[model samples]
Target: MEIMQSLTDGIMLGGIYGVISIGLSLVFGVLGVVNFAQAQFLMLGMYVSWTLWKLLGIDPILGIPLTGAVVFIIGYLIEKTLIQRILKAPPVAQIFLTVGLMIFLENAVLLIYGSSFQSVVVSYQSLGFHIGSLFISAPYLMAFTAAVIVCAGLWIFLSRSWFGKAIRATSQDSDAAVLCGINVKQVYALAFSIGVALTAIGGAVILPYMTVSPSVGGQFSILMFTVVVLGGLGNVAGALVGGLVVGIIQSLSTMVFPVQLQNLILFIVFIGILAFKPEGLLKEK
Candidate 1:
């Protein structure tokens, strides 16, 4: 029973982690920018949702569209203002830009929101249900459901939409996309915006299960990176696979290993994967 419980908890946790990784993976696969500020974007998302709820009493789920829209503008402006200039530069230069952006965004948020921990403070967030011998928290269950829906939606959009084809074209061959009368620049911005929107939605989904702090995104970001790499670089579906595997690994590790030590399972698996199958479990598109 205890083992089963840990597996369930891990799946729940991994689902939350999966949502964050999807955004990071998308941006990296398409634009090749690591976007180290992904965590900060996540923090900003949590802060926005919290403020909206506190001031106007808006439901967090209902505020999903509003959060996505706000972050969408911010992300698009970021690419237009700075990232676009250094797009042709070396990958290391791009890394520095993202690092600086991460610092600026995190410090700015800390200055404004402080280092305190915040939660949505909803009643049902702590509640759960029993399905057979398994118990599941409402927040975790909801996070899992939302994660699945968002991932599914992303797949459908990428596979079915015309804009998705344009985006795919840009990702595959930007110069070709430009020569073919497609606005590759616009595709870049649009792709990035949709990517960040996922992070915003991730923040909202995990609010009930985790505390939102100015630096919370930092912690989540690294784990998301590990998952992204484990799933293979540039593969969106791989992010889902990697996220669930890492989640289950960490959760189940608690049975024999200390709780804090569970995090190592991700990196260990990551290293093993790199050592064996460098392309990851799935080939990156």
Candidate 2:
């Protein structure tokens, strides 16, 4: 029963984890850039949601669209102005640029929002339901539901929409996409925008269960990378699977390991995966 309970909690947490990591995967897929600053965009989304809740009395979950929109615009602009320039640069240059962006974003938020931690107070924050002996948390359920909806919407948009096809084509081969009459530059900007927006929505949904601080993105940076790498860096569907696996490992480990050692366990798994299956668990042949 206890193990079952942990599995349920892990699934819920994993859904949200998938949502957060998808953006990083998308950016790398389409742009071929390892965006070290992607998690900072998650932090930015949290701040946007927090601002809306503090000033307008909007619940963070309810403000997901607004959070996504705000971050989407910011992402679009950043990609156009900065990332576009480095699209064809050497890998080291791209890495340094993104790392610098990460530092700038973190310090910028610290300057603007200060060092205080913030969180939302929603009606269902502490509510939960029980199915026999397994209990489900309200915030976790809501966040997981939202994550599912977002993932489904993204899949439809990617597989059905014309622009989505263009994005996929660009990812497969940007030069070929251009020869096929697709505007590769526009696709890059839009893909980056959509990627970060999805992550921002993830941040919004989890506000009920998480506190926001300037350094919060740092907490999830390594975790996000592990999820994406575990699933395959550019594989979107793999990210969801990886998230579930990681979430389950995290939850079950807590039963036998100390809280401080939970991440240590995850790190071990991450290292093992990298050493044995660098192509990721879901890599295609």
Candidate 3:
């Protein structure tokens, strides 16, 4: 019974993970650039939601769209000013660019928001439902549900919208997309902006249950990358699956290992996946 509950909790956690990973995957899928700063945008969303809640009494869950919009603008401007310059640069240059951006953003937040941790208190924070002898946390369930909704929206936008089709075409071949009257540069910026916005939504949804600080990105960075890589860096469907697998691994590991050692197990799995399946489990052959 305990093990089953843990698995359920893990799936809940994975829902948020999947939402965040999808953004990362999309950026790579569209632009072919691995953004080390992606998690920082998650941190950014948390801060935005936290501010809105503290200042105007907005519920973090309810403020998800706003949070995503704010992050989307920031992402758009970033892609235009910084990421665009590196689109054709060496991969190493791209890595350094994003890593530098990550450090800068973290420090900028520290300067603006300080080093103190901030969390929101919601009515549902401690609420839960009892399914037979198992317990399901309300906040987790809410976050998971929100993630699913947002992911579904993303899928629809990517598959059915004109801009989304252009983005997909750009991802397939920027040159070909250009010949088809698509603005590849604009598509890159839009995709990256939307990607970060999605991640922001994940951050906003989880705010009721998680704390935020400038350094919060560090906590989830490895885990986020693990999910993306496991799902195949640019594969959206794979990210969702990887997220569930990672969440299960985390929950089940807790039954045997100490809490502090939980992430260590994840790291091992990440390394193993990279060593054996660099292309990821869901990558199309």
Q: Which one is best on lDDT? A: 3
Error of 1 at 50 (Å): 1.0
**What would the per-residue lDDT of candidate 1 be over residues 1-285, giving only the tens digit for each residue?**
988898888888887778778888888778888888887888888888888888987766667778878888999999899888777899999999999998998888889888889778776776989988999988788778888888888888998999988888887888898899998778888888888888888888777667888778767765887788888877888888888888988888888888887657666877788789888787865
**How do all the candidates rank in terms of TM-score, highest first?**
2, 3, 1
- For each candidate in turn, the TM-score is 0.95, 0.98, 0.98
Q: lDDT of all predictions, in order shown? A: 0.82, 0.92, 0.93
Model 3 residue 256 lDDT?
95
Q: List the residue pairs that clash in candidate 2.
A: none
Give candidate 1's whole-model lDDT: 0.82
Q: Ten-residue segment with the worst summed lDDT in candidate 1?
A: 262-271
Q: To one decimal, what is the Cα RMSD in angstroms of model 1 from the true structure?
A: 1.5
Query: Which segments of model 1 are wrong by more than 4 Å?
Result: none
The residue-by-residue lDDT of candidate 3 on 136-217, one tens digit each, is: 8899999999998998998899899999899889888899999999989999999999999998888899899999999999
Model 2: per-residue lDDT, tens digit, 1-285?
999999998999899999999999999999999999989989999999999999999988889889999999999999999999999999999999999999999999999999999998989999999999899899999999999999999999999999999999999989999999999999999999999998889889888899999999988888888999999998989988999888899999999999799789888988998999999999833
